[model samples]
Target: MAIKEGLRPGGRSARVQESIHSAVRELLETHQRSTLTVPQIAARAGVTPSTIYRRWGDLSVLLADVALARMQPDGEPANTGSLRGDVRAWAEQYLDEMSSEPGRNMLRDVQCSQTPGYCVAIIGAQLQAILERYPDQPGPSVDRLINLLAAPTVFRILFSAAALEVEELHRLVDIALGQ
Candidate 1:
């Protein structure tokens, strides 16, 4: 049955890819990225190592896709009619995302990647998009402001497991806005 299902094309391949990505994510949840291997992912996905390799080439590419899926934002940014409001809303969203189980796991996995620059580039590109989306704010350094707001959440999630709340986000906004 599984083999016949695998032989089917189009939608079946998408489902298989999704399953493989999900299996990789679950494995990251249970184990460190350093411990992940193609064999482990294949075993967990109930597919052969050849299948994984045929689909993703190697573990890094598979892990990258899984990490991206895990880190995907829930929705577009909300504008509250003020720079402070928009930045705060964005910060809160980022904080919530960074604090999630899958988000934390993805961060850890990306950190362990041999080419961490790729992850950094992905993050930088997202930040750039946000700035492009909100151009009304007149600030000395928007990038610095974003870094300030995001660094704390990333730090807490990576090192301390601190629970981020709305108040903290508000405080960060106040600091960022110089208000």
Candidate 2:
């Protein structure tokens, strides 16, 4: 059955991917990223270790995919008309995610790993959403805006014990907007 399923397209592949991703998330809840093994993930996911290796090549690649999947926003960023409002809404969501224990762990693991591009991809998606709203306005570049909005929150998450204050987040948005 397993051999036949592997020979088919789409359906089995999708299920395997979903199962592996779920197993990764479930394991992350209790195990550190560095401690997770392919064999353990395969057991939890109900797939063979070869399936994971064949599909993802290595644990780093699998971890990258898992982090990217988890970082995907629940929905599109809110479009509140004004750029400031839109940015604030997005920033608030980003900060809220960063404040959670799971979010922090995911971010830390992804950032520390060789596959940091997953983190950058999430930020790029947010920047693209913001840019789509204001096609003509003269403002900071997408990269600059991403840096301005993300850097402070990430720094706080990495170094400080304090929660990111709402006012501070607004101020960061304002700074990004060059206000």
Candidate 3:
């Protein structure tokens, strides 16, 4: 029994870590970043502040990990033969993913003061990946169109509860393509 117990990886510590992370994520999704605190998270996780500090070092690091986990890299966009189709499809995917609870919480973390630099870097990488996904001659035009369409959706995601509907997407496409 002792050997079996010893052989069990992570034992209680791993469960504690996962519980803390899940609690943090839940708190972040429902509450503003400013409201998130070590004690609150620890209480929700049923652990002590010292346990969190010992494992993650600090609140910022712990929050960053939570945000990163929530923003797990989505698969790259697919090529649909035409830039317009590709851009629209990409926009759809981006909106769908970013509308999730974790995604919204990730945005909150980025906009909050805890890790502005890290957030900028992450957003930049996402933008660059978006640009790279559609590299064709009218590339600049397509990129700009994508930006114009995405900006408002991003605004809504960050600032309001407005859902991006298919009609809005179609309208944006028309405006972007001058149709």
Candidate 4:
């Protein structure tokens, strides 16, 4: 496995990393990213600050790592055998994820930090995977699809009080596909 910032792939070190990550997630649910401190996270994770420092360097690095980890999908989006079905499934899943408190918190942290485009990149990668399955179909490019799906969804999630309805997602997909 790939080592991350000198962290070994497994063993007690792996457990330590898991604990730290868990602590960060747990803390993030109730704490603002700017207010989180290494000592607080260490205490929550049952490790010393030096352990976190040794693994991730500082609070900013640790938060960035946590944000990136949270942004990852638990698994690949299901292949529904058709581009429309797959895109709709992916969009629904994405909407569900972003509507959660932790997801919003992570998005806020990533947006406010130096890695503002990190979430967009992650979403783009997911869209690219869906697009790769339909090489013969001619429609909007991956970037355009991302804009159609992500841009408005993120805006509504972060700004507007309105909920992202399922019909809206389908309409967006249809529009993107020129259907």
Candidate 5:
């Protein structure tokens, strides 16, 4: 049998990772993030500090990894009758979520991690599901929709102090749909 080099889901490694993620999340809820150390997380997770370091390289990256996992949607995007409707619905929902305080923090964490664009891929999957409804007809690419919709929404979320308006989000959907 071939050997697996790293973490694999639903296996022993997954259990360790999940434990670590849980520890980090739990600790963050109870204590200041700045106060947490790798050893504390390792102790809470029932793993060694070296294990966390070997898998995640550092605490910041580990935090980012956990944040990204939390950001995963519970379900696929809602199905609307038309592409425009679906895209708008998804965009509005995305703006609502990403503009929130917790969402913004998660967004920042994943950005600082070794991998960027993990969030983009999550959105792309949902967007692709929406596009599948219009298979016989031509529609905007997922990348195009992301650019015209998610990118701007995330920009306002991360940088702007004010909340993003739904009207502005729909306008982005319109631009993506070329309307």
Candidate 6:
């Protein structure tokens, strides 16, 4: 079955993906990621190692897939009553989350994936939701915000010794907003 399930409920591929993803999540709760291997994951997932390789390419890719899935927005952005406020709040939140240990690991997993665009689209959709909230006002495009806001934040978190300060995040918001 294809790793990328159609998400059709109860389908064979969907069930397989679900079990595999669940198995990975379960194992991570008990074991260090460095200790995991294709064989172990396959055994826990009740699928063959060949199945995992054929679908996801490698364990890193599979972990990346799981990370991307987890990164999808749970709900709409916070409503702060103004585009600036909402955008700023979102940026601050983004910086906070992405700079953390787990978030950093997830970002690393995503970088190892072949489909980085999917992760970008996920973040873009999140920003789009914030943009949609204030339709009456002009705001930066999601692409622009990603370039100015998210990109820098991710860069600092991934490359720099420290994540952006809240002050820096605020400045990024100002720039992204063209303020």
**Per-candidate RMSD vs. true structure?**
6.5, 4.9, 8.2, 3.4, 3.1, 2.2
lDDT order, best first, reads 6, 5, 4, 2, 1, 3
lDDT of 1 by residue, 100-140 (tens): 87677677656534444554455555555556665776542
- Candidate 3: clashing residue pairs, number: 0
Considering every candidate listed, which one attains the maximal TM-score?
6
Task: Report the candidate with higher lDDT, 2 versus 4.
Answer: 4
Top lDDT: which candidate number? 6
Give the Cα error of residue 69 in candidate 3, in Å: 4.4
Which digits, one per residue and each the tens of the lDDT, describe model 3 over residues 1-179?
01012223476866776788899878866897787899999999999999888766678777766765556556656567666676677678768877776567666654533434554454445545645665663444534554677677778888786768867987887677566
Worst 10 residues of 1 by lDDT: 1-10
Over 4 Å off, model 4: 1-17, 28-37, 50-61
Candidate 1 local distance difference test against the native: 0.68
- Evaluated at residue 5, the lDDT of candidate 5 is 33
Q: For candidate 3, what is the TM-score?
A: 0.57
For residue 24, model 3's alpha carbon misses the true position, in angstroms, by 4.4
Model 5, poorest ten-residue lDDT window?
A: 1-10
Task: Give the per-residue lDDT digits (tens) of candidate 2, residues 1-179.
Answer: 12222334458777888899899989988898789999999999999999999877788777766776677778888999978888899888888988788777766656534444656776878778887889887666777777887877888887899767889889878888889
- 1-179 in candidate 6: lDDT tens per residue? 22255444568877888888889888888998889898999999999999889888899989988877778777888898999998888888888888888789889888876664887788888889989988898999999999998999999999999998899888888998999
Q: What TM-score goes with each of the models?
A: 0.64, 0.78, 0.57, 0.77, 0.89, 0.91
| Cα deviation of 80, candidate 3, in Å | 2.1
TM-score of 6: 0.91
Q: Lowest summed lDDT over 10 consecutive residues: which window, candidate 3?
A: 1-10
Candidate 5 accuracy as lDDT: 0.83
